[model samples]
Target: MACVAPSSRASPRRFRLTSTAMMESAPTTRAAITAARARSILRAVSGNLDVPGGEPLGYADPIGKILSFNKLEMNEALPPAQRAKQLGADEYPFFGYPGWERNDAANRRLPHDYMHPPWAGQTCVGHARAVLNAMRAGRPYPVKAAISVASNPLLSLADVRKTYEALSSLDLYVVAEYYLTPSAALADYVFPICTTVETTELWHGTDFCVACPSGIQPLYERRNTYDFWRGLAVRLGQKEHWPWENVEQVWDYCLAPVGLTFQKLVEQNGIFGRREYKRYEKLGFGTPSGKVEIRSSIFEALGCAPLPVYREMVLSPQGDPEIYRQYPLVLITGSRFMPMYHSEWRQIQAAREKRPDPLVTLHPETATKLGLKEGDWTRVSTPKGAIRMRLHISDMVDPRMADADHGWWFPERKEAELFDVFESNANILCPDDSELCSPEIGSWPHTALLCRVEKE
Candidate 1:
């Protein structure tokens, strides 16, 4: 590991990991993701990012790459001043990758905004930051009024205290969700949203496209995200902007590019398109050079390191020697738990029965050293904050590390306690301090965090 300070922005130091034997063939070998022979891989919602199958070459669905729609670039269409003020975008140019950052056809021709938001293109991290900026004394593009769709920031983003402060500061905050989550409970108005089974959705699988049938009509005034936005737009005299009355009609307009209709898509089950591996050979890569950018020129132009670099955790033992003295044990967090979606289903008894308590796994040896045993409630504390978790004695984690599960909340608790979100929730221990985040898009550390564990 060779420490190189390539840029002032990566970190105080960037650890370059390169095999000594492959140093001579650095460009050709896969030992390091250097600028010479590596391709930039950005997954900005062509679908099949983590699905069963997609193009072997990239994460993008071929339907988006090949038969894309002619959606105009919203930001570029704006005046220069307005375009320059695209919330947290100018400061983090990487955030523009989903908008007009890449020179690729698929990304440039972003078809639909859909359930996604305009300010936050792909990087969901922008969600919290946008609010914080709004609360700041003199930050650009401060969000005064906002509407959140089906996201629980209190359990999702790091630094729950800060997130609460930022959210509470919003002048007009509305939430569109199925249930009143901790975050939604704070909203000025909460609109009931329908589930996936109740709302029609156009799902694009590996190589096929299908319209998901609504199992049942939405129960009593519950609406999908699209309808929510359409309704608001119509009331605001922007009805012409949203022509499609419902999602099915919107899908029909989207399918028109392929001379297909939503009704036909449902009737035929699905339509599969053939995959072509080296389509980049014909269209070239999305970089300015029309090739895979191992050392991204875009990154270089943005005053960032062209190649990958590593930095020690902001609160690790090495980074904070004094703090590490009392807090000797290393804590890892922000990982997903099984049988439940992110921060959801806590109210569902079935999911809770499977994994009842929030768990932090540690090697039995590590547990015993702390005078703790299997299934002991441990108070996991970091410099940022602390949370209580049931300790699970296991060797799945290193003896020196305690691995904590994320998204824990007791819905049975009274709403006055914010459903006891502060307890057992991992995000409470994770802080979104700017120094502890990624340089590209301000994405905070989800794992490799530092902390100590003691019996609660």
Candidate 2:
């Protein structure tokens, strides 16, 4: 049987309907190819070409607007030399803003008077891996101070030992979070941030926009991110830059270009733009090619492979046969759960009740061989480290593969010590070696790695 989901091929009519929808929505050659592949799966399921007649669907072109408004107007409007100074611009030319000026500009006015940060030829010396390196060496310049917002680098980042050492060595570490995460516990100061539930938000999904109104006022000493930043700006003698005291003032400013306020948008429910497909036919893709680049011109210019490829993991059995003998199972991490978002929501009793503990899913056959049964406490280990989790023996995974949920920490544990974040965090198993990353992007192998599981 195909790996395609059952819902994707539930009925012949449904298959044809979705195929037509996909075709209508596909705006580029790349998208068309993806749509075709999806349709091919449906064709395989239906076993005939007789299925017909589904309405052509169209979405409210939000991405096209956002690209034109935010990127083209606000970002690209900056001086070319200034844009060139954005971090990693020299090393990763594809991600640089200087090249993006060639793209089409948006016609819509912006709501707020937003200004790009004047980076002024400053290098992006503070990327994730680079920051860790700075903390380790203190070479180019001593990075004595650090601020973390809605992040838990120690649990989320690869090489827990290195992260711990780097964080421990920092002279000033401050974190803003709802809970005291492992990374937060190491901080010199931990500020209480208001939960998303207490704040208003505007969601831009690229096809449509929704204005969400705040439900409850912030209680206690809790403050929104903007308030925190604005307060900090005042103390840092940058108060002139932050004119807006609250989210309402900021939102109103942002809505000014469209003549809509946060309150007005909330009254109107939401706004959407007209869907115009084949936009490339008129304005062309925002690329040097003026078309969808099958092979990236940027990559080619950088002397890297222009086309994308799928290669076996560097530490996989196929990649390293010697290591495969000792570590057999294919470990996959970063799988998500609906109740929890990444590393958050663990503190909620209801959410925690739904998923009482961290789990590693394994095939029943694999479990039996390793002397593990359903709900058995097991230790999942890699060459880097090990974490204990309950075995959830199911046929959901292949016999040779194990899938574990990431962002594991106990809210019930002592908050003073960050609730034992290291006990079952999946990132502890990943490595951050340069050689182990992608040739172009430097992405760590978070999902695919070699491992073994045994009864703990």
Candidate 3:
């Protein structure tokens, strides 16, 4: 089904009209009616009883499964290893070079290896190339490693910590920062970077669903990323290697590849350069077959499934029904709010006041049954660790579900300490073994978890 917007300012509404009939109707009047009908249609669709509160329709159903399975079968029909080799050669011509292609090549080498710390694993040869380039240039490390031990992956913070600790053990000097835990305390140097609003840039991304220019100045003299990078480049004696002299130059370069000039983009404020911005269009998908393959022969060559299968995650609430009975509530941790990115906003007084520390949200019915009250501090624990947070009883959560706002650091406490050292981090609760990861993608199950909450 296709939806068309009638007016710019009107709230978006959806209408179910026969495609043939809708096309035959008067354009202007039909648009107005469609806009009005969208509201009513949306209301009717949402009124269905099976729809969970705050959850859109068909969420739990196997929508992606159906699509992926079909693609998988089609790809499996191709000769083994041919598809992988073909895909590797095409789509990303620069895979062997020092650009996005190299990144893709690295990612492809370990498509199922997502369990590593952020940008830590050396997946591709390109990463090695970049590392070598930096080393040869006498450049201070091109990558800064930051660890938020409080809300690492739900699989195993210890494993991540061990891996990073091993990496840090190497002579590499990494710039580090910790949100709520002192994981980054091992770094040679630490610099505090401000929140998004606290800084300014010529934001030119289609993520906000709007093609508008955002012009705002930095709230404070805290160094912006571009300024920092430029300053560092100068310090490294490689100023000329960076074009455009300043951020404006880099911004211009980004737009220069396309027909748009920097001055024109700035003048337009933010032009809707492209109407159809498919977010996942470039997922290493350009095959001669020109189809999204769920079953990749590449994975088959690697003795894996190309299909997107939902393997039961280890230590997850779903994996152990018995654990569900004990814990009762499925916990979703580390989701961010608009005003904060992880734990960055905690330092801002206004933002801190608005959202103080971590909050445990539970269904009101569950809260009542457990003899818990809103605003009461409660402890949530797993086999690995536990932490305490203020409660927010609401129906917004499922009766059998609870969530803890992540990325809070108590400055008064030890830099990285939260709760008790042995029983604090959310990751401590998650099992570190490989069983918690997706066998196919190596993606960790961060969303699904079983936990019990008690009044502290």
lDDT of 3: 0.45
lDDT, residue 431, model 2 = 92
Give per-residue CA lDDT, model 3, range 1-456, as digits (tens). 221222121233333443223333322233222233343233333442122232122112111111111111222244544433322222122221222232334343322211111121222112222232343443334333323222322123333334333434445443322332344444554444433444434443321111223355544344455566567778998666555455545555445434454567556665442222221233222332323333444444454444433344455554677877777677777566757676455556787778765788899999999899999989986554577788998898878777876654554455443323333344444543445544433334445677889999
Show the lowest summed lDDT stretch of 10 residues, model 3: 61-70
- Model 3 quality (TM-score): 0.56
Can you tell me which runs of candidate 1 are displaced by over 4 Å? 1-55, 58-77, 97-120, 123-127, 136-142
* lDDT for position 240 in model 1: 74
Model 3 misplaced stretches (Cα beyond 4 Å)? 1-186, 192-221, 227-240, 257-260, 274-285, 337-339, 412-428
Task: Give all candidates' CA lDDT scores.
Answer: 0.67, 0.67, 0.45
Looking at model 1, residue 98 earns an lDDT score of 35
Query: Which 10-residue window in model 2 sums to the lowest lDDT?
Result: 106-115
lDDT of 2 by residue, 43-70 (tens): 3234322112322122244322321124
Report how far residue 201 has shifted in candidate 2, in Å: 1.1
Model 1: how far is 56 from its true place, Å?
A: 2.6
Question: Which one wins by lDDT: 1 or 3?
Answer: 1
How do the predictions measure up, each by TM-score?
A: 0.81, 0.78, 0.56
Candidate 1 has what TM-score? 0.81
